[model samples]
Target chain A: EDQVTQSPEALRLQEGESSSLNCSYTVSGLRGLFWYRQDPGKGPEFLFTLYSAGEEKEKERLKATLTKKESFLHITAPKPEDSATYLCAVQPGQGAQKLVFGQGTRLTINP
Target chain B: GAGVSQTPSNKVTEKGKYVELRCDPISGHTALYWYRQSLGQGPEFLIYFQGTGAADDSGLPNDRFFAVRPEGSVSTLKIQRTERGDSAVYLCASRMNSNTGELFFGEGSRLTVL
Candidate 1:
């Protein structure tokens, strides 16, 4: 069975603090890994997509790195505005368009 | 709108009642998807439509949950015999193609069954 797990269900960081969130996945064949940021009362906003191990992508203060079995979302000097639930999802290589998602990490940046 | 759109931002109904949720994907987008998000959990895949055909509906929990996209642009998710367990946020997303793997989501419709 394909599964995705995200660790540190919740995290609190002071403004300007940096942290990392983890996403571990088990799939038949790895196709793609995705990261999203979701704010309260809204749907997830797309962040990045990593297709292979050792692949990395960055946007603003966020960077995402991927491995064979895990992915990491690293936040650099996070601001209060950056507080949101970070979601990770994976697509298997079975040609299905469906994506399996992780529970997500709730992040809080206190000023 | 420029992005995907979902109707009935919030819905409250009683158990055993039927409900319909609508989604309008961006123009020219051929791949549309539906997902359900329970409280404090990630969105779970429900169904996927490629153009006017349902490419995959395996994620749907049961027969009571059905979705259709006739014109290939707008889709509707119909839930029959709504249960308290059916209460969740239904999300709709779209992409230009399936290979890209990046989906643009809409503000979901929050469904509450009591």
Candidate 2:
């Protein structure tokens, strides 16, 4: 089965702290990996997509990178508004259009 | 609206009642998806639709769950004989038919079965 696992189920960081959330996957083919941020009582918002190992993408205070077996979402100088559950999902190369998601990492940035 | 939209921000129903959740995809998005999210867990895929046909419905747990996208622009998920276990936030997402692989999600509908 294609599986995605995220580490550090819950993380607490001081404002302006920097840290990274990890998402490891075991899949037959690597198509694209996605990162999203979800707030309480709301749906997830898309962040970035990593398609290959050694590929990295950045937006504002968030950066996402992918490896052969895993992906990382790095937050630099996070603020209270950045507090949310970060989700990672993997889409295989078969054009299935279905995503296998990890149990998200709930991040809290304290001011 | 420019983003995906779901109706009835909150729904409360009895255990045996039937319920339907609606989703309006962003204009021109041909791929629509439905997912269920429980507390402390990731979203679980329920179904996927490309145009008016269902591309995948394998994630549905039982026969009581059904969905339709007759017109291809909006979709509805129907659940019969709802159980307390069915309570969760139902999310809807849509993406362009092209291979950008980016999904835009809505503010999910919270369902509570009593």
Candidate 3:
């Protein structure tokens, strides 16, 4: 069975603090790994897509890295505006465009 | 360009009532998808429409749920005889193509069953 699990379900950090969120997956064939940021009362916003192991992408203060079995979302000098739930999804095999997503990491950056 | 948008940001209905949720994807997006997200969980795939045809409906929970994208642009999700278990946020996303891999999502329509 294909599954994606995110760790530290929730995290609280002070402003300017840095941290990393983890997403582990088990799938047949990895097509791509994606990261998204979702704010309260709003839809998810696309962050990055990593297509292969050793691939990395960055936007603003967030960086996403991928490996064979997992992905990591690293936040640097995060601010309150960065507080949101971070989601990681994976596309497996060659089926439809269905994406299996992790539970998400609820991040709160306190100022 | 504007992002995906869902109608009736929130809906409250009694169990067994029928409800319709609308989703407007970004213009020119060829792939549309529907997903359901329960509290504290990630979105689960429900269906995917490539153009006017449903390329995949395997994730749909049962016959009570149906989705349609008539002109390959806007899509609607219909739920018949809704149960409390069906109460959740329905998300709509659109991508340029299946292989593009980047999905732009809508604010979602929140459904509450009483």
Candidate 4:
């Protein structure tokens, strides 16, 4: 079974604090790693997609990096508006479009 | 709209009743997906559609759950004999094509089984 585990189920950070959320996975084959941000009572918003090990992508204050076994979402100088549940999902190879997602890490940036 | 759209922002139904959730994917998007999300958990895949055909449905839990995308633009998910366990947010997402990995999601429909 393809499984994803995210650590630190919830994290509280001060404004401008920098930290990283972890997403570890064991998949049959890695196709793409995705990051999404969801707010309360709303759907998830696409953030980034990392396709290979040693690949990194960034947008604004967020940076996503992927490895052979895991992915990391680094938040730099986060603000209150950045507070949301960050989700990690993987699309396994072999022509599969379904994504296996981790439980997600709820991040709160307190100003 | 430019993004995916879902109907019935909230729905409350009694157990054993039938329910249907609708999804309207973005224009020109050929790949559509349905996922269920519970509190404190990520979205769980239910089905996927490519054009008017169901490309994958391995994630559907049981026979009671069924979906159709006849026109290939609007889709509906029907649940028969709904149970309390079925209460959750139903999310619909769409991709431009199989070549792209990012899925644009909607606000989701919150289902409450009473």
- Chain A of candidate 2 gets a TM-score of 0.97
Could you give candidate 2's per-residue lDDT for residues A1-111 as a string of tens digits?
Answer: 889999999999999999999999998787899999999999999999999999999999999999999999999999999999999998877666788899999999999
Candidate 1 stretches with Cα past 4 Å from truth are: none
Native interface contact recovery, all models = 0.82, 0.71, 0.87, 0.84
User: Which DockQ-derived CAPRI band holds candidate 3?
Assistant: high
Error of 3 at A60 (Å): 1.9
Candidate 4 TM-score versus the reference? 0.98
Model 1 agreement with the true structure over B1-114: per-residue lDDT tens digits: 899999999999999999999999989999999999999999999999999999999999999999999999999999999999999999999999876669999999999999
Q: Compose the digit string of candidate 3's lDDT tens values, residues A11-56.
A: 9999999999999999989888889999887788989999999998
- Give per-residue lDDT, candidate 3, residue B78: 95
Once fitted onto the true fold, the runs of candidate 4 whose alpha carbons sit more than 4 angstroms away are none
Q: Candidate 1 residues A12-40, lDDT tens each?
A: 99999999999999998988999999999
lDDT of 4 at B18: 99
Off by over 4 Å in 2: none
- What are the iRMS values of all candidates? 0.9, 1.4, 1.0, 1.1
TM-score of every prediction relative to native: 0.98, 0.98, 0.97, 0.98
- The Cα error of candidate 1 at residue A68, in Å, is 0.7
Would you list the clashing residue pairs of candidate 2? none
Writing each residue's lDDT as its tens digit, candidate 3 over B1-114 gives 599989989999999999999999999899999999998899999999999999999999999999999999989999999999999999999999976669999999999999
